[model samples]
Target chain A: MAETIPLEQVLGTWVAALLTLAIFSFLYRDNPVYKIAEHMFVGVSAGYGVVITWREAVIPDLIQPLLDPAAVDLAGPNYVVLIPGALGMLMFSRFFPRYDWLSRWPIAFVMGYSSGLAIPAAIQMQLLPQLHATLQPVWPAGEVTWWMALSNLLLFVGVLCTLAYFYFSREHKGALGVASRIGIFFLMVAFGAGFGQAVMARVSLLIGRVRFLYDDWWMTLVAPWFGGG
Target chain B: MRLQIPLAITFLIGLFMAVQFFVPHEVFQYSFESLLAWVRIVGAFALVLGIGSLLRTHWDKIRRRRRDWPYSIVTIVSFLAMCVIGIGFGHEPGTVFYWVFENIQVPLDATMFSLLAFFIASAAFRTFRARSTEATLLLVAAVVVMLGRVPSALIVSFGDTAVGHYLHANMPDVSEWIMNFPTVAGKRGIIFGVALGAIATALRVILGIERSHLGGGGGGGQ
Candidate 1:
C-alpha cells in the first residue's frame, strides 16, 4: 500500500495542469497567475542547478575523491583537478566585496578557455567550411532543368549582390550599386524565412501546452462520469 | 596593461585550440579536451549569475513597491517557495521538490512551447500576403511546403492532381533549378564580394584600422 499511488501524486498532476493553463492564459493577456508560474519556473531552475552542482559536480568529482584519496584505492589521486575546482569555488567569494578579487582566477580561466575555444572553432567550423563549400559550378548542367538552372543562377547572383551589399570601403556607383541593392533584397528574404521558422517553432511549443490543458485536464474534469462520481 | 594581457592570452589560447583541431599532438589534444570540459563547468556557473540578476531585479521592484508591486510580491513568494521545495528534498523521489519539478515544471515548459503554433499561424497569415514578385514566390513556396507536409494536402487539388503531390513532386526539380541556376551564381557573386570585403576588414582589424567592436572607434591608435 505504501508503494501504491498516493494522494499527493494525484493532486500534484492536477495542480500542475492548472498552473500550466494559468501560464498559457498569458498569451491572451498577462495576469498574476502567469507571474507566479514564471517565478516558480525561475526559482526551481536555480535550485536545480545548485543541487546538480552539489551532487554531480562538487561532491563526487571534486570533494569526495580528493578528500579521501587513499580510501578509494586508486593508483593515486589526480591532485591537478583540484586547481580549477578551487578556483571555481573561490568565485563564490565575489558575493562578498572584501574577497571579490579572489573570483578573478576562475573568471580569467573561463574567459581564457572560451576565447581560445570560440576563435578556432568559429574559423574551422563556420568560416572555413562555408568558404570551402561556396566555390562551385557557375551554371547548372547535370540533371538540372531550365528552372533549376535559372534558380541556381539567381542564387549565385543573390549571393554576390548580398556580398556586395556589405562591401563598405568602395564607393558604389552605377552597376555596383544596382547589384548591391538586389543583394540586399535576397538577404532580407533569407532573414525573414529564418525569423518565420523561429516563430513557428516557439508557437508550436505553446500550442502543445494549450492542448494538454484543454484536452487532458479541462475535458477530463467535465466528463459525464464526473457528474455522478 | 590589463587589456593588452587579456587580449594576448586570448590570441594564444584561440590559436592553440585552432591548431589542435588539425594537429595530431597528444598533449595538445589532452589540453584542448580539458579546456573544453572546463568551459562546460564554467558555463554552469553562468546560471548563478543569471539567477542573481533575476533576484536583484525582482527584489528592487518589491522593495520600492513600484508599478505592479503585487506582481513582484507574487514573484518573490513563488520563487522562495519553489526554491525551498527544490533545495530541501529535490533528490528524494517522493519529496515536494521532485513532485513539483516533474509535475509542474515539465508541463509548464511543454505548454509554453506549444503556444508557438498559434503565434506562427498568426504571423504566417500576416506574412503570406503577396504584394511583390518575391512575396508571391515566398507565398507559393510556403504554401507548397505546408501542403506537402500534411496528409490532408491531397484533398486540395488543381485538376486531377493533388496540389501537395504536384508541389512535392516538382519541389526537388524546382529547388535544384533555383540552387543550380540562380542560387549558385548568386552565391558565387556573394562569395567574391564577401571575400574582398573580409580581406579588407581583416587587414583593418589586424592593423588596428577597424576598431568599432573594440568600442573606442577608429583603429588608428598607439
Candidate 2:
C-alpha cells in the first residue's frame, strides 16, 4: 500500500522540480525561463541572507547588546559595538561623492585588519606546516625502504623546483630553466588531479537532482495523480 | 586629517589584532572575542548595503527598460515576497517563508551551481588537446584520476574482470601517489610564496607604504 502524501509537500516538489529544470534550461540556450529562474535565485538568496544575518548575527551582536546591556560579558555594556557600528555606517558614505572619503576609513580598517590577521595565520597554518611536513624523514619509522626514500626525495625536489619556478628575480636559464620545466610538470599534475576530483563532485550533484526528480517528484506526486503506485 | 587618521587607524587596529595572537591571558581572550564581535557586527551591517545595491541595480534595469527588463520585475517581486514573508512571519520550519526557501531557493541555488559541471567539461574538452608536453601530462593525469575514482568493484560488476582487478590493485595507489606527493609539493610551494607575499603586504600597509586601500591615487596620501 502507498502512503498518502501531503498536498503542501507535493506542491513544493513541483516548485522544486520546475525551478531545477528552469535552471538547467541554460544548457540549451539563454531563455526567459532561465532568466526568471536566475533572477528569482538572486532575489531569494539575498532575502534568505537577510533573515539569516538578522537571526544569527544582528540579533545577538547588535540588538541583544542594546536590549540588555548586561547580557554581554564585556565590561561597560558592550559599548565596543559603537566603534564598528559607526565604521559600518561610514560605508554608506560611498553613495555621496563629496563624502566618499568617509568610506575609505572603513575600507582601510578592513584591509589592514584582514591583511594583518591573514599574515601570521598563513605563516602558522600554511607556510610553517608545509615546510615542516616537507622536512620530515625521507623514510617513515617502520618503512625503511627504497621506494619510500625515493618518494620522499621526489617530494622534496618537487617542492624546491616549484619554488624556483616562482622565484622571478633571476631569469630561467640553464639549471633554473630545467627546474622550472619540472615545476610545470608538478603543477600540471596537481591541476589535473584537482580537475578530476571536481568532475566527480559535479557528477554527484547532477545525480542528486536526478534522484530528486525521480524518487521525490515522479514517485510521490506525478505517480499518485496518474493513479500509479 | 583624512590620510593621516585612516592610516593611523589601520596601523593601530592591524597591529592590535595581530598582537592578540601572542597574548594568552583570559582577559586578552575576552578582548579579542569582543573585537571579533565588532567585526561580525560590521559584516552584518554591510549585508544591508549589498542588498541595497542589488535592489538598485534591478530597479534601474526595470526603470530604463533595459534588455530583458521584464525579468527584473520577477527578481524584485520574488525578493520582496521572500523578504516580507521571512522578516514578518519568521523562518521557522512550519512557516511559509521556510517552505519557500526549502522548495524554491534551495533547488534553484543547487541546480544553478551544478550547471558549472557542464562548463567544466566543455572547458576540459577544449583545453585537453595534448598540443604540448605539459598539456599531454595534464590530460593523462586527469584520465588516470577519473578512471581511478570509479571503484574496482563497480567496474567488475560491469564485467571487466582482468582490467577491474588490475585497476583495483594499482589505480588507487597511483592516484594517491599523484595527489599525496606531486600535488602536495606544488601546492605547498604556492602556499609558501603566498604566505610570504601576504606578510610583506601586511607590513607595507602597517608602515603606510601601501595606501591603495584608501582609493584615489592609490591612497598615497592627500
lDDT of candidates 1 onward, in order: 0.59, 0.83
Top-lDDT candidate index: 2
Q: What are the DockQ scores of the candidates, in order?
A: 0.27, 0.62
Give the CA lDDT, 0 to 100, for residue A157 in model 1. 65
- Residue-by-residue lDDT tens digits, candidate 2, A54-118: 87777778777866766655344666677888998988877777777777777777776786687
Cα lDDT for residue A44, model 2?
87
Question: Can you write out model 1's per-residue Cα lDDT over B1-222, one digit (the tens) per residue?
Answer: 423433444445545655677777899887876666555555556556666777789889888988876676665665677667655656677777677777877876776666666677787887677897667655654454344344243445543466666664765554434334433444454555554555455434333344343332122122
TM-score (C-alpha) between model 2 and the true structure? 0.92
Judged by DockQ cut-offs, the docking class of candidate 1 is acceptable
True contacts kept of 1: 0.32
lDDT of 2 by residue, B1-222 (tens): 878888988898788778878888888787777767777777876788899999999999999999999998988898889889988888899999999999999899778768888998888888788888888878888877776776664476646677667777788778888888888888877888998998898889987899877874332337
Residue B131 Cα positional deviation in candidate 2, in Å, after optimal superposition: 1.5
List ranges where model 1 is wrong by over 4 Å.
Answer: A1-12, A53-56, A68-75, A89-105, A137-146, A218-224, A227-229, B1-12, B44-46, B63-99, B116-222
Docking class of 2: medium
